[model samples]
Target chain A: MIEFHLNSRSGLSPYQQLVQQVRHALRLGLLREGDRLPTVKDVARQMAVNPNTVLKAYRELEHDGLVAARPGVGTFVTRTLADDTLAAQGPLRKDLRRWLAKARLAGLDDESIEALFVSTFRSTAGEDVA
Target chain B: MSAVLRARGLGKRYKKRWALQNCDLEVPAGRVVGLVGPNGAGKSTLLKLACGMLTPTAGTIEVCGGRPAAGVEQLAKVGFVAQDTPVYAALSVADHLDFGKRLSPGWDDAEARDRIRRLGLDPKQRAGKLSGGQRAQLALTLGIAKRPELLILDEPVAALDPLARREFMQDLMEAVAEHELSIVLSSHLVSDVERTCDYVIVVVDSQVQVAGDIDDLVAGHYRLTGPRRDMDALPAGQHVITASHTDRQTTLVVRTDTAVHDPSWTVDPLGLEDIVLAYMARPADAVRDTRPALEVVR
Candidate 1:
């Protein structure tokens, strides 16, 4: 499932949030192609949004070929994007840069930043992955 | 799609008073439905029952198509933000987020953090010190971050100023559009409901007055205001839901989707609030043998 949230104080729309999160998750390899998302109702309920809103987002996703809907079954991620592209332009590189920016702003030494990033990355990725 | 919430003859009682009665409703998937009524109309009771926070005394209640009670696995699918957007006064905005992360198994911490950043809320600032609007925003954030299947908000922005209310509603609508979440929000303000919901359920005196698509209700229902005309003269297939009189003029609200090719009095379009108040003011004995003076839609 693509876990979602909405900020009543943010400039972004709820549909945008849903779209971004689902795509971000796909790019991060957190949600693989063929991963079935919660039903539109399910997403709506969880996110405090209208089902129409979620439907619009899903429709957009389907249009983008990022998700495939099976009649009477459910919506799932489709293996349309190449792994190489998924490995490159998604969240991984962006997340790394984000961590780097934070570390640099905190005035951390290069070695300290590297150690922190490696530890945090390992923890997030799982002990076995490390 | 499965019904996210179901109520059959579900009712609530408060001492000698009946808050809601003979209520039967099925909330289908993928809609932002609004619950509206006057104070003490049992709107809160209905929401509480749907959230499984209150047990019904008279009939069945279900959330996510199962019993709406404590420990029902389906409870995990419903996210409820109660009235007043309560939060710990002493906790920081960040602390509240941490609490949500710990308590809600489906909590999306990253999303919550990102939202906080996007909203420009000082996560480290004490929640008690935040303004009412900020508090409501935080409550909304927590509710949305849980990722439940149904989110029920009880007067979520009732405390804010007009600007704040508009912002809150806009934000909510945006989120609804983004997440496609089905929301059941309760409010006494029909204006808010009118702007935010496509579907509406009017709870009056602890009873469901009417529930349906706003467009259907509007297009199906008409306001006839004109010279006093006998109801019997009105065309067949029209059912009057409410009627009023002022000397020579009789105003009636009737539902006729087939179209009134010709009518006795001029028909008028009813705004959402007008229709709601019409039903809210419906007299117990309003349904009478005499046809209300019918006015033709011009």
Candidate 2:
């Protein structure tokens, strides 16, 4: 079972945070196909959050085809997101480490490096979509 | 969606003072609604009016499709936990349970006992000996075991420490999940409301400043900063809630239904706390001319 924790400082809505955490776990291979997600009541009780928030997050996941809720049973993961991208992570990690070292050696601070990476990442992704 | 609590021009008076006045509210069923405001904002008076502890002096108020406390059946439809989570100091925990069982027609003894067991409270202990958190939980148990369709709580956790408050909220949410109960809880803690409530009602200076779904309220409000300009020069769709200006720059919090397409101003979304604070900071009589009275938009 995957236990969820909330970061109040994250500035994301509770339901959005739940959705993101599930996606993060799926991509990290911590959750795989057929895994049962915690029931809405359990999550609400454990996290001290409204059950409707949990229900909304589950509905969004179901819409994305990542999970399915079976009547009178718990929700189950229907897809694994760790297939294609998992294979390329090693090379990507090496490249990212090398670039980070180069940036630090060039006198960029941690915040500057993060800002640079995030802006470049967003613009590149936006261009691809456009 | 049927309204669990509906009020139109509801007002209450005490001697020469109006505790709450000109209030209009329509709360939909199955929502955990947060009623937040400063002290003396009349949150308690409004809650008392809803549960029929106090009668309206001006207009009508309906709860669960009937007048509040109109009859035994009407009283059975709504449960209330008054301020400070009041419990009988002399009674034992079990005695309190018995009292609840004898009074409420829809009492659920098994559920109440199971909850008490999970909470680890001994039934033999007197209520006065319990900690503040424990006492609050005991009161909440009474409210829930009655199986009311709508539960109204007035500052239920204000006296407890943070940890106790968290556990109390956890139990409350679990009960809502199990019973599909609607809630209207008043509090001064915005962060708690943001975390546990789907709907929000901001009562400031004895009036409802704003009420809506939390997500909708957050999405529809924004903070804009740009060159100094007159408030009247703003676009028609952007209704300013609060504005502050320096000689060179103007900052405003606005509620707009449409997107802010103006390139000159830097617009950023606001968190629920910021939005509520902005409304609270506004002068009671200010901004009435700029926008119509804010209402719950379905």
What is the TM-score (0 to 1) of candidate 1?
0.67
TM-score of each: 0.67, 0.92
TM-score of chain B of each: 0.91, 0.98
Model 2 off-target regions past 4 Å?
Answer: A84-130, B290-296
Determine which window of 10 residues in candidate 2 chain B has minimal summed lDDT.
B287-296
Native-referenced DockQ of model 2: 0.60
Taking the tens digit of each residue's C-alpha lDDT, what string does model 2 give over B1-298? 8999899989988998988887878889999999999999999999999999999999999999999999999988999999999899999999999999999999999999998999999999999999999999999999999999999999999999999999999999999999979999999999899889999988888888888899889888999999999988878878889999999999999998777767678777799999999999998887355336364255
Tens digits of lDDT, candidate 2, A47-121: 999998999999999999999999899999999889878899999999999999999999999999998987577
- Identify the leading candidate in terms of TM-score: 2
lDDT tens digits, residues B182-266, model 1?
Answer: 7899998876675567678888778777787765666667688888867787777777778778789998887775555454566
Q: Each model's interface RMSD (Å)?
A: 13.3, 1.8
